[model samples]
Target: MGIIWSVIFSGMSFYWAMGGRLGVRSLGGALYEMSLNPSPSFLAIVWLTGFIKLLGAALLIMLLVHRHNSKLDRKLFYTVKIAGAFLFLYGALNFITISLHAFNIVNYNLDHYATFWRLAFWEPYWMAGGIIYFLSAKRT
Candidate 1:
């Protein structure tokens, strides 16, 4: 499930980086605007993000396939845990940040669509990925 999430999200980034416009508005605000006419740097950034997500998926794959070596397994466990922590914190922090904006506790430049997706879907999705990675790593 975590691998699926990472792949799907990464695909979107790849699509956008390749100038595919579908679902770009869901990004919202400056990001959506930039997607319409992305500069080279923005394209690079998008590609980097896609690669990062793929790295998450790849890490899980490594854990699953490379279990014969005990030393490698130990390192993989800690690495996956670190990745899980990153995903969990990324989601949780964004969720909290958006929630704060909703209540006017903080001021962010998010639009209605961005805020809606962040609160209702994206943030939770990332958190789910984190939990899934943690469980998968433990089981492996």
Candidate 2:
């Protein structure tokens, strides 16, 4: 289940990394209609982050599979735990910020919400891997 969810998230991250339009709208109330014509630097950062996230998700799946096959591989288990924790943190931070921006919980510029929809959509799965990893830790 974790691997499946991670793979799905990796696909979404890949799409975002390729400058796809999944994150081009707001997910909160009041249809936000702002120009997405951001500076090149901003776009570059977004793409870079997306790519890194995609890679991380892929690595997560690989690590989990390895751990599954080698129950005695303590090192791989730790790696999975750490990686999952970090992924959880990353997604949690993004989720909080996006939710705040969209729901007007914080006074952030609405334009920033363009990427909110994409991240918000993957929030559940983003943390699912982490939770799975943590739970697996107790088993072996």
Candidate 3:
């Protein structure tokens, strides 16, 4: 059970890292377009956010790997569970951020309904799986 949760956690970390990479590329393009009349503060914030995201994803992957290797220990198991919960929370935040961006509530509209629904629904399913795996591993 611990091994299973570790795998799930690792998979999610990898998925998030890939997503972050794509976001960085897209945002870089957008930033380039805005550079003609650039806001230095805005550009700084974008770069900072990208760095944090990439670092967090890397940390998550490392945590998952460590957890997988130490699955026999209760402390490591709990650590994985906590990390999974954090990932799910991050997913929820990402959903909200995308929605805000798409709706033009904060930034210009960048998301369509199709992409919104895919992230809002499909992404949460994996989060739920991660939570379930954590809970079941506790039972074992």
Candidate 4:
């Protein structure tokens, strides 16, 4: 599941890098506008992010397939733990902050389209990835 989450996110990034338009507006604000007319640097960053997501997926996969090798497992164990916590907290922070602003609980500035997607989809999706990463590591 963690691998799936990472792959899907990477796919989105790769697609955007290649000029795909779907869901781009959900980025909102400057990013959305920039994506529509993406500069070379922007495309490169998107592509790099896609590869980064693949790396995360690869790490999770390593935890699944490699066993009986105590040394490597120990390192992966800690790495995944840290990565999982980061993923969880990243999503949670965005979710909480977006909910606060979207609901008028706070008067923070956020793009409307971004708030909708982050609140309803992206942040939850990230949190789910974090959970799956934790579960995978636990099995390791």
Ranking by lDDT: 4, 1, 2, 3
What would the per-residue lDDT of candidate 3 be over residues 1-140, giving only the tens digit for each residue? 43444454445434433333323223333542454354766556555555644553443344444344454555545655776687577667766766677667766434354445536564575466456535543422
TM-scores of the models, in the given order? 0.91, 0.54, 0.42, 0.90
Worst 10 residues of 1 by lDDT: 131-140
Can you tell me which runs of candidate 3 are displaced by over 4 Å?
1-72
Top lDDT hit: 4
Q: Mark the 10 consecutive residues where model 3 has the least summed lDDT.
A: 20-29
lDDT by residue for model 4 (35-111), tens: 87888999999999999999999998888785688899889988988888888999999889878888899865457
Clash pairs detected, candidate 2? none
Cα RMSD (angstroms) for every candidate in the order listed: 1.6, 5.5, 8.1, 1.8
Tens-digit lDDT track of model 2 for 1-140:
55555556556545644556554464333322321454566556656656665665555555545445564566656766787797678778867876776677776544644455535465655676678655554334
What's the lDDT of the predicted structure labeled candidate 1? 0.85
Q: How far does residue 42 in candidate 2 sit from its true spot (Å)?
A: 5.9
Clash number for each model = 0, 0, 0, 0
